[model samples]
Target: MNLILFTVVATIGYATAQSEQYTDRYDSLRIDDVLANKRLTAAYIKCMLEKGKCTAEGRELKSHITEALQNGCSKCTQKQLAGVKKVIKHLINKENAYWVELTDMYDPKKEYRHKYERELKSL
Candidate 1:
């Protein structure tokens, strides 16, 4: 388990500094409020989460990243899905990983809320 722990720590360390863009507040709104904003890119959101500069939880950051994928991406194949999930697992807390992993099972025909029902309910 030492290697696994080391990998996790290394990943976390790499993500600790995203962009210098974030100031104390954005238009009087907290960082969490702006996370799901349509204008932000997935990369930017991922960086923000990695930096962990704001008070937003790991789950919240993953939610926003998933939301961005939903909005910006077309239907993803299994391979694409796996990559998104891999990123989520590395980015969020282990406790929140299950929920994000469950989200990877998304079907384009189904709504986002319906897709993650089990994970959400369990939480």
Candidate 2:
């Protein structure tokens, strides 16, 4: 009886530790996604501010990034998804700075709307 109880407790402890590790990894991945998406969105906004019109390219870029983010978070915990959404909303509200950086990165000559698509697909 004592050995059985000890084994069970050890198993539970191992499982709990593994769960915590996975949770931490998921959190780190989510944070990376948030930062990357923000950078991409900021670049798009910058492009629009400079051009006086939101370039179709910029719109497509934003849409693609949003799609990537949504797909990536499909299996994430609700808390993780909520955190990402908050970051997105904050970035969207930074109209001027985001636009400035976006404009600098916008290339009217490139067709890269699918830039992050492959990364999302692999996930």
Candidate 3:
């Protein structure tokens, strides 16, 4: 990893700023189901990469990805954070290519990749 429109995590939550934190509309998404479905995962990946059409959730996610990654997702709700962590873990361990692609896109300067990597390893 630069910029991850495919912050896959972004697609999972896609929160909007309302009050002090991000909205919780997508907080109840089933991340496990998404991860287990290759087609769904591919769709998200394509969306993130700007190679395919985005679902509403994907569009929302893409909008906030840079801000979310740069700011450590400070606005995310707890459930969204948990889902993000899970998705990051999956990206790091199983989908390294996508992870790299996302990182390269979102963290082009390598600003947040190492930080996230260390954090994920610790978890």
Better of 1 and 3 by TM-score: 3
Give candidate 3's error at residue 94 in angstroms: 0.3
TM per prediction: 0.23, 0.28, 0.81
Q: Per-residue lDDT tens digits of candidate 3, residues 17-93?
A: 34657667777778999999989998998899898999887887788888899999997888878888888888888
TM-score (C-alpha, index-matched) for candidate 1: 0.23
| Model 2, residue pairs in steric clash | 43-102, 45-99, 46-99, 46-100, 46-103, 47-102, 47-103
Error of 1 at 56 (Å): 22
TM accuracy, model 2: 0.28
List the candidate 1 regions with Cα displacement exceeding 4 Å. 1-46, 50-68, 71-78, 86-93, 97-114, 117-123
Q: Which has the better TM-score: candidate 1, or candidate 2?
A: 2
Q: Choose the strongest candidate by lDDT.
A: 3
Of 1 and 2, the candidate ahead on lDDT is: 2
Q: Where is model 3 more than 4 Å wrong at Cα?
A: 1-18
Q: What is the C-alpha lDDT of each candidate?
A: 0.42, 0.47, 0.84
